[model samples]
Target: MLFATEVDAPGVAALERVVLDAERAGYAFVTFPDTPRRPGIEAGVRAAYLARRTTRIGLAPTLHATTTEPFHLATQLASLDHASLGRAGWVVGATTAAEDLATVGRTGAGDGEVADVVEVARRLWDSWEDDAIIRDVATGRFLDPRKVHHVDFEGSGFSVVGPLITPRPPQGQVVVIGSDELTAVLDVALDVALVRATDVAEIATRVAAARAAGAALVFADVPASFDPSLVEGLVDGVHFHGGPPPVITASPHGATLRETLGLPRPLNRFAVTS
Candidate 1:
């Protein structure tokens, strides 16, 4: 069983303390809600800071795809993975309101468009082959250009071309956490399903459907005080909120969320084969 906490309780210092405590208490991951500005730091910036403060705990920050450019989002996530050594996850969603879209110079975005953004991110992540960087000092060759492929992604919401400036992350593809509406799109394309439910039965059903749909892991959004064991067989993990600072423990630490959940590290589909 794995535990999680949302780092948005009191203030920045409190969030830091909660993250450090969660790391100590053997929590699998901590999520930073992506509230634009409501008496809290930005999720990505907050996660970057927390990444430096803690080791072995996954740092997942909610990111809205509609407001942010897909290439920028991909780059940010890839950088976060590097900073966290493969412990980064993207909790992505899209904005539906026209006014909100206007703030970012975008229009006509929906839940389905979020999937396209995620796909673009994935393609960019795979742009550079794992062994693309050779660093052959003798030949003064830093990277093998042939190994880097252009994404050439064209979608209704956005379009992109060429490889990402950053190389593929250590995790290849960072874990993706999405709302239940993304279940169909995320299935076979993403990693984790972060679903909200009002009751245990609802949680069980939703989680089961997500699993059946192709999610490797499913986390039910619940109170931080909720018992992880209650959803033991129902879901893979429990995402909680409103908890005190976690304390240190003796259990083994997982470098990635997959490790924390006993799931095998996924192989990169774009990886070169000998």
Candidate 2:
């Protein structure tokens, strides 16, 4: 398991160096952009670039969720997963601010609704089954039309067209982690479960709940301001930590933010990160 920070904006030059260095050094993942309800387009592009440079690394936002087009988000994830050979995961959240509410031009999607969207996204990932695309230019055939599948997803707050612009992801599932607020629900239905707990007992409780919920993996988020003395007693499988860079954030490596954190790869790869 690799622990990385979720910044509010894209750190292009810094991110480039961080991700490339991590890849070169065998580090697994680097979280680049993490906007609230604004949109992850910029962050997603940067993360994709990181994916393109490395063979085995996962890219995600610490706290990223979009009220943006479901189709667009799914397509982006597919494209990234394809580029990364299925190394994409999303630590998603529900929008709460009124301003964020207006960004999607719809009512807020609470935990349940966001979870439903996640379900839709997962379904969309499977919209076009593997081997669905058979590109044979010689016969004037680019793709086997019959292979495409329209999910026909019609939800209360969102609706999506059938098949995605790309094919299915290699992993068949992207890491989906939730926060402390929705851990219980996410643990039950999500692939990747996350929580911000204060102690070993809390961590154990969350992890157990996540496992009971059938999660693929569980992660914990930590901040830099925490005292190292306080980190002595807690025992957890993994912890995620990050801030900006030395240029913008405090520690050059953000080591002060957290330690003993990991990122899960293929499954949960402990990631050393930016």
Candidate 3:
């Protein structure tokens, strides 16, 4: 996931070039931030464009799930997935600070309600099942009404209606990810896990917990600032090298995320958590 953190429109061109270069360099996805500047300045739409411009590279707004409407968020995310031919992942995070909540007119609501928000987001993702679409012009039938199901989600934090406007995304549903403690939901549901920590032991702990919480992929985080010299030390520091433990995610010093994750060579995928 190459993060496009450019804060201006002009920077988008540079981001697009970088994503194309990364894709050629063996990168898999292009992920950006969801900091919508104003009406018509749609950031997610830009992300979708990035996905559309490149083939085989996934698109995601990793760790930007705090200040947005759940319904709008789901629709746009599904649109991105569909528009991208099923290569979108969403990394959901909470607004831990009061100002972030207030940014969206949310006040006094920053009381660890992230999991609830994540639940609602997932329900919205699953609101519509596959095969819900029917382009039948013969009988003026367009949808299998039964295939579209209401989410009927009423979490303490919020609720979402069923049947997203777009058909169920080709990826079935966009990958719903939660960083850190957001992985403790008893149901233990998520397609991917990212362990953003400087310490191998700490990340290993998180990977184990996430696996127990039921995750498919866990990517260890090693920031770009990680010294290349330290790679040897970190490799030696991998908790379970010879034998596989329940879960051990190790982030080694490298220039790109693929290097850190032992995925040959490629572009980066970190927002710096060290």
RMSD of each: 2.5, 7.9, 10.3
Local accuracy of candidate 1 as per-residue lDDT tens digits, 1-274: 5566677756778888778777878888888876433355678888888777778888999888778888988999999999988888888765566776776776667545677888889889889888899999999999998888888988765679968999998888888887765765533345778777748888888887888877788888776566666777787667776665334343466776556666676555566442
Model 1, stretches more than 4 Å misplaced? 37-40, 184-188, 242-251, 272-274
lDDT of 2 by residue, 1-274 (tens): 2333454435567666666555444333455544445454566777677676766546765333445567777778777777776677666656667776676575565555666677777778777666666788789787777666777888656678677777777765565656645546432255555566657567667667666666655655555443323433332323345654221211122111111123232311111110
- For model 3, the superposed segments whose C-alpha errors exceed 4 Å read 1-10, 34-43, 110-112, 184-188, 225-274
Residue-level lDDT tens digits of model 3 in 1-274: 2221112234678767766655554444444544423334356766776866877555666444567767777788878777777766676755546766666776655344555566666556666555556889998998867666677766657776665677766665576644545676434355555555767577667777877786655555455444323334322121111111122122222332222223332111110110
Better of 2 and 3 by TM-score: 2
Among all candidates shown, the one with the greatest TM-score? 1
| Native-to-model Cα distance after best TM-score fit, residue 271 in candidate 1, in Å | 3.0
Top candidate when judged by lDDT against the true structure: 1
Question: After superposition, which runs of candidate 2 have C-alpha atoms over 4 Å from their true positions?
Answer: 1-10, 24-26, 36-41, 62-66, 183-188, 224-237, 244-274
lDDT of each: 0.76, 0.56, 0.54
